[model samples]
Target: MSALSSSVQAVTALWNRMPFVGRVASQLTVVNIFDCATRLAAQAFLSAIPVLFVIGAFAPQAVRDQLVESLRTVMGLGGATLDQVQGVLTADSGNVKDASGAVGVLVTLASATACSRALQRVCERSWHMRSAGLKVVMWRWVAWLVVLLVALIAQGALHDAFGAGALLGIPVSLVASVMLWWWTQHLLLGGRVRWLPLLPGALITGIAVVALTWGSRLYVPRTLERSVDQFGPLGAVFTLLSWLIVFFACITVGIALGYVVAHEQPFDRWLRTSAATGRTDPADDADLAEESAQRP
Candidate 1:
């Protein structure tokens, strides 16, 4: 009875020291799902301006007309019914002029900036660390660029080789998705080391992300469809809100999992140590202090 009592006390103490552990663990299970949804939303928002710029800057009239026609077909709109859209696309001056276009470009740049800042905030919140500044941000961008280039090239090659009918595409897509998650985590966490150190934890987290994303894709959309069918367009708003909740939940989980995978000590142990010491590790403390000092 005494031994059992002692074990119970020990377990209680551990939980007391790391109250967030169970919550974080449960949350981590859904991390990728939330991350995918939030990231998709953020990307959609940020990419809109740039996409417009690209259309205006590079696409020819024929190409633009073809794109409009494609969209019309997809949306089941009447033929050439997007006349206003074409006019907007072809508008030469006034509000639609290039100078006015700069506003969207600036907004896009701001969104990108916000994403980097938000990523840094996530790192700080999760690991008690901050990235160095423009240098770190630039490096992170370069890393992502490399990852994106590789994914695009590989995806094209694989799709061409396998044709549209092959099952190999799924696995290839999964692998690419994992690589992307890994790269993003690596960048956000200031893990600019050799690939060896970065790959293992990144791979683990990436796989988790891929599984969650695939599952969400399979399930959430259908669920949302049902809700919309039952509740009308208002249901779409609820669906979006649900997506946001899931997205943040996934991010918290992924951050915790990444920290666990990368560190030597378990979170419970670290939490206990921090509580007992009444302070974080000196390195973490210094990093936080530095970040505070650097903030504008």
Candidate 2:
């Protein structure tokens, strides 16, 4: 492990000396962001299916339309893709639907809960950090659900306050989005990273998320068109999966870039370097303990 770290440090030190693009390229190779993203996206999408079904049962037309439009903006779902999603979600059939929906909800919730745990593990792998204990499990859920609540409330507040004023609305929305993203990162990875070091990545992620949300209008429709032709209703599923993959990839890159920029030392100071908080890297802590054992 020490040898591998030494090699990575040596390569990273050299790679760091290169231009920004070169460093990013090297780090991207090191992180396996795409593989991690694919797993996250697939897991999330599969687990969301039954939740969508339950949501379909109670959500009003106006609510569903708003959601559909948001999906179009974020994942390019419209036309047949949009119709298919609603059909699957709102397959109403009285008691049969209720019974089946209840079962589906339980199964999907369990899957989503497991996948959320996997997501934490993936973050640890990507950032090369410590495993969390069962003690943190409840706190993690609290933090995550709190962020989701904040996001929803913020969206509603913004719309209610600025529904008529486009000139005043855009900046407010942007600010809200940025704040939401930052808070989300803080909650998601707070124990592993400090606030100061986490900001850059969170900001990058926020901007990327906004860009994706806006740009979905341009690309999502065409993608959805192709997806439907290729796989019928499943096309919406796959298209949504594709969007999720890119979204997670953006998140991984943001975290990595923040770490690269925040925690790395200059080449000249590498040997004597300490991290921002003057703490040993968690990755090296175990090895240091083991080495201490051998010395005595």
Candidate 3:
């Protein structure tokens, strides 16, 4: 516990010290944000095709009604707008038993593959690693996609478990969200450091994600209404992309923080001193490597 406490303290101190590192990290994220968001947006759009088919074609009326109720209750959507959104989400393709079609499956698979590939690239950049061999990439792609699917399903259960109606839900959701982010980070980037070291970053990311999810429900309907009124059906595209942008940006920043913290890079050292880059100094590259090797 003593060692754990010290490690946590070191991370906190470094985080408080590294505004410049954070700024540089932010710039780097901006460099990759558009590409990541585009891939994620494509995946979402493609996934909706199958989801709509399932809801409209195979789901019982009771299930559909429950879904509509959830949306209206959670997202503050109703009336013609809710109907319009539901209309767009629920497809008229296939029948009760055969809701999914060959085309829908093919497009969905392709979009998921693209998303995995894009995420692999982003993770590599975030971790400052050179690209891996095809086999490694392929394995990670499959694993990450499965993990993502699980996360999507689990979030509904999580929200139910940590009912947002009460004050208790806030801390419970934060812990749940942290666990989810930890799993995601480990899956997407592979282990470069001890898992415990990433907890602080995951904690921050989880809070941000939970906050955004709660806030988005309140904001998205209004945004959707405005977007549709001004841009017609194309407005939905704008609305979806805008949501993706915010999520992807937060994820990028969170991962960046995870990297720095996990590597035990003390940004406070940089902040505190105007030391010349003296290789002979104790706080040099060799010392950093030795410390990293010591981190187990």
Tens-place lDDT per residue, model 2, 36-153, is 6787787677766665665566556555555554554446567876777768655663653567566775565565565555455544444445555667654674456435434543
Clashing pairs in 3: none
Off by over 4 Å in 2: 1-16, 19-26, 58-65, 88-97, 100-106, 142-170, 190-192, 264-296
lDDT of each model, Cα atoms only? 0.51, 0.60, 0.59
Tens-digit lDDT track of model 3 for 1-296: 99999999998899879866765565355335566556666666666555545556655665555566555543445556678757744645345336466665555555566667666555545555444567656776767776665455345445565455535656666787788777665565554333565565587688888787778778888888888889987886778667777776677667656555544446324322113111133334344333322321
Report residue 108 deviation for candidate 2 (angstroms).
2.7
Rank by lDDT (best first): 2, 3, 1
Prediction 3 TM-score vs. true: 0.66
RMSD of 3: 11.2
Q: Candidates' TM-scores?
A: 0.55, 0.71, 0.66
**Candidates by TM-score, descending order:** 2, 3, 1
lDDT of 3 at 220: 84
Candidate 1, residues 87-192, lDDT tens digits: the string is: 6556553444465466765555555455455554554444545445676676565455445434433443332234663356556655765666656755765653
